[model samples]
Target: MVLDAYASSNPDQVHEDVLQKSRDACYKARDAFYSCLEKESGKKPTEIASVGLLYPKECSLSRTEFVKSCRSSWGPETRGGILEKPYTFSSSSSKFVLLISDVSGGDLFMLEFMHMMTKLRPFVHSFLKEASKMFVLYIYTMGDRPYSRQMAKLLDPKGEYFGERIISRDDGTVRHQKSLDVVLGQEKAVLILDDTENAWPSHKDNLIVIERYHFFASSCKQFDHRFQSLSLLKSDESEPDGALATVLKVLKQTHSLFFEDGGEDLSGRDVRSLLKQVRKEILKGCKVVFSRVFPTKSQAEDHPLWRVAEGLGATCATEVDESVTHVVAVDVGTEKVRWAIREKKFVVHRGWIDAASYLWKKQPEENFGLEQLKKQGTDEKSDDVNI
Candidate 1:
């Protein structure tokens, strides 16, 4: 049997959907494995045991399509049960085992920290199939909460696999600490699985030492690096080194600069509030400027902050040539608007510029703050903008 680890994006913010997708992926993988086995053994899979997990709201597997699929695959299986509750299995019968987990945010971080072991599934399944005394556990981690009761409803009605539990935030350093301990102790061979980086370490003493296993922790890093690199377009001939181009260039180099998970995107609702604040500041005789990090050209064109500037009756310039280093040329009727990204810093030209045509009215000097004012404020309501 071939044991493997797979990772994919969570569907939107719905925790249930995320769990479902992960489980579906596992089944598909299992089916493929079975088909391969047929080619090798020249016989269909006689028996199988499986465990599936869900994250966030640990809803039990009800009599849903997901649970039904497991039942159909393994055949007239035993009825479902709850997490942390243990059940016994026949070690004499042939068995196949599957495990599922749902991970999010820092809870995921803890899992990644452990050097994960792979190939335990096939080994455990084969072992159970050969021995009459077999025990299989399906565990789920609900991120920071304990949703074991809900998850129990999602379990297989058949009693082929036993014991289900939810890993809570306070259970240990990791959300699913007890589950890890049980898997390590009960199963002679074990495989640690997850899609996120930084899975926390649980009871170090209880960890199972599987001599033969594979680790796959580079999953998240590869996706994250690719996301950061291709986020913007500086290759456009019409606006190379322009506002969008410069912003992209800077952001691509700064891997740590990420949109807060769930933070409003710079080009979305947050932009509106920021722009409104800018206008309010300008009206109070203060100069304000806006800048952004765009991972793509389309995003740059649709930036909300830019829209806010237009709504404020402020003249806006975009796709400026590389020779130009200013983002906006503004006028509060006192200090002209001048902003740009230069040498990886926000360069606001302090020189007076004609409000109507972005033409410099006077030379910029170091003491420009003496006559200019800067104000900072935040929106009371958060917007749906994310990086």
Candidate 2:
């Protein structure tokens, strides 16, 4: 009764200095209360930043801890385990469920290992072995010739997939740019999987943008991405449904679609169109709106992010309405964000759009919540900053 009275009488409800919690307990409460706020905001983390909440002040500590922890509890493994079936294409903000509020300190290593493996995303041996069948594979990188050859040896030890097909920076025609001109394959039939889009400015139609695998502080700093490299983490993506596995499936489809006979010569068929058709399946029917993601003077349609979203087949509108399925924003304080929360619409950061575009599938919106993204999207004008 005294504690309750003190809590009620306290003028500053925003602070949790009155209570001290364990590492696990603090994070757990934070997750629970955020989970609660999400429920209050209509069961989606993207729904509201933190509207009027029923949570006590102590949970606020989790937000502070969150900056330090930052989704250790929200790994894809936590999202897996029968709660979600494979190929489940649901909204991450609202419908997603967590099996545990916070992983115990003892299991932190295992969770981190899983997340590390997922993010590390090494060149899959099986994927390469199989991929060699459908298409002629090559390793064209910005890395120096010696480093490129060494990495290629590590990837294709037998020299089966890319035997002498490797091209490095020294062999390129342009400076600080990657071009398909160095590649002998026909542009229409070739498909490129690269981490950086600017590396292939003229061949985006032929490019499949894969998420970068940052393993070093040097790479992170070079990219200006604030997140720690996966090299710092402990180990694994689930083998069955991880990025490599998913990409292989997509590759198979692309190959099938390209060779799909229509009693016409395959010479004129463009794999780029087929690749775009497959990529568009990710956010095909969704309508997205932007909130402070674009510069005030720039046309939203002209923004690279807008083009990426539209390329994924989502309709982008400046204003929100019933048809708006998502409002992509970096600022949680924006009016559009507020309207999205009240309307129970999915409110996510711009990374969600890019993630969908990169993975060629819809990423969990909860993972890219505005609050979650503010750390990365501090400079909203840096939309070109790949997550």
Candidate 3:
């Protein structure tokens, strides 16, 4: 009330021309960025502008301007991901603004969320068919409403997949990050498949990180990766072994474990607990050998990565043998790496194992190939160091 009276007493302070103009510019930038979000709800989020600010690849240009124009006084409300002030979007259909009449009653929220991945990913129908058997599927994303609904049609032309269970940015009650509260299912039974990990900080345990598909060159440059995208290179993950397939395997396992007893009483099962075992099986039954990855003075078994590989259910061996399925190394000329390459086994960089650990799923070995070198390996004994 004091501030209101002060503003009335001092109209000059409240009507400052420069401050009002700056705020107008900020609001315009915010609206444009958000409009882009509304239009490209089908795209996966790849461009991470900051710690919690991740948006679809198509919103890159507008996001930069939004940040640049609004870096001044906008507070991070953790709701709309805005930086300056209370972000208010009035729907053209109903201008009924949600001015909180009661804060203690857990005030209603008009959370800005969009069901991203609005389109059916490659092989999505099959995955959904299998997933629908064990889990209720929901398409929760950071996208606009009209585009989101349009993409939903593209993803589910016959309305068989998500039905009316689509959750868009406009459907959310929280801001900045996405939450499972928007979902009707309990947190224990819900599993999320998203590429951006931090977008849902409150529910990392339920998240299953999926490999991003950058089908365009413009998408690759936004992430600033040193290498070109698979699409630009005239290749992509094989359909049978791509992320959708890999995650399908994980989901099926989770389903099996959740109902392993066959008693049908699901009150005792928690997917979060079963995920640990499922993740361990990512590299199961594989024997791995490492070379030139650890210091000469350190024990190979004592290295951190050795533990990571072991934790992923891969048996670590120092020697190249018939049993070794993978050779993890930094240098392509290493004895073990060369042996694995010659024997048609997987020769992968340390990042391959690290990726598996971080992603909770085995990454493609092709993406983690060791950097090729010009020198030929010095002649060593036959690959069969021991049986």
Candidate 4:
């Protein structure tokens, strides 16, 4: 929907005049509203933004009425199976959900993937409304090409609703932990999507590490799978479309458990049994991880359920130790953040140079203002340097 303020800031060159005409109507409404208001109200009625024009043209959102327009096609009344029912939101205490994945095959499928997500925006909204925490990450192993650029569009459409929830980067050493550390700072939900088959050196082993982190956090969820398409089927393709469809259905439908339910009450035995069943369902295929993040020391000490988590084949770690190697802190507000590596007893206070570069990659502006500083640091000799 177009608001009566700042709509002219962006207009398609092809339809500039048409959009301007529509915006003119909004301007008139804003003028009328301002005309009736008293100056003492301390508000100016200016032409606001057109939410419809904010979407990419290829998304077919020009005729969009409201943000809700995208979601009007969801729920049981529309079509599909039981999972097809409109999502029933549970109040989320989380501020974000982090989705980290190493998507294979470059960026070809990203647009279509985001289109499908935008289609599901309504359901996402339903989940967010009840969620206390909010944030979702779609991190790719492949670096700064189509994935990073397109993810920015999907996460922050129309240049609003920005937060710590959506972060993407390619630094192998710090990508997983750094992103998770930042997301957990606000105790938000996390959804890690690993589509790249060999994302890490020991991906299967890394999955174990990730599972431990999630289980300990008490505020994380994950979804990982290999990328495949059913539409690729040509006549006599002999690709077993039904089997592929069944697996996709199970992945999409059952993956909701990652977003909705916390899966908290399951004990080690229960988790093992459930895993066994899930394994049986896929004939020993598919790997799933469920975890919880505990934020406070007292919480961990009082409820050592995380200790039990390791028994279920998940690693459980507490990030409280000052001497706990592997802690990397990146804070935009801090002059210098702390960094610690494994077996390192000392915490190094690195200047914001590298950290700032990292942030710039994630938060690029019209003009990057830190180039001179990076050049200076590149010449300096320091162990703290990590740019």
lDDT of 2: 0.60
- The 0-to-1 C-alpha lDDT of every candidate, in the order given, reads 0.31, 0.60, 0.58, 0.29
Instruction: Tell me each candidate's TM-score.
Output: 0.21, 0.64, 0.52, 0.26
TM-score preference between candidates 1 and 2, better one? 2
Query: For candidate 1, what is the TM-score?
Result: 0.21
- Across residues 140-248, which tens digit of lDDT does each residue of candidate 4 receive? 4344434454554443444333332233453233543333332221111233334332344432321212211111111122332111222222111112232222223
Span of 10 residues, lowest total lDDT, candidate 4: 210-219
Model 3, position 143: C-alpha lDDT score: 66
Error (Å) of candidate 1 at residue 166 is 3.9
The regions of model 1 sitting more than 4 angstroms off are: 1-89, 96-98, 103-137, 145-165, 170-179, 183-185, 200-225, 228-387
C-alpha root-mean-square deviation, candidate 2: 21.5
106-139 in candidate 3: lDDT tens per residue?
A: 0111113331221234666676666665555567
Taking the tens digit of each residue's C-alpha lDDT, what string does model 2 give over 1-387? Answer: 857776676556424544433556867966775564433222344433221211112234332243235333343322211112332212221111110000001011111111211112444677776776565567777866664565555555587766656666866778988776655434666677776778777887877766655544455788887676544543334456656666778778887786665323454566789888988888988999988777676787898889889888899998888999999877667788888899999989877887787667888888988778656545466342211
Candidate 2 worst ten-residue window by lDDT:
98-107
| Number of the candidate with higher lDDT, 1 or 3 | 3
Off by over 4 Å in 3: 1-120, 284-311, 314-347, 354-369, 372-387
Ranked by lDDT, the better of candidates 2 and 4 is 2
lDDT of 1 by residue, 83-193 (tens): 221333222222212233432110011111122211122223322222212223444454444244333333323335433333344333333343443232222222222
Worst 10 residues of 1 by lDDT: 104-113
- Number of the candidate with higher TM-score, 1 or 3: 3
Query: Which candidate leads the pack in lDDT?
Result: 2
- Candidate with best TM-score: 2
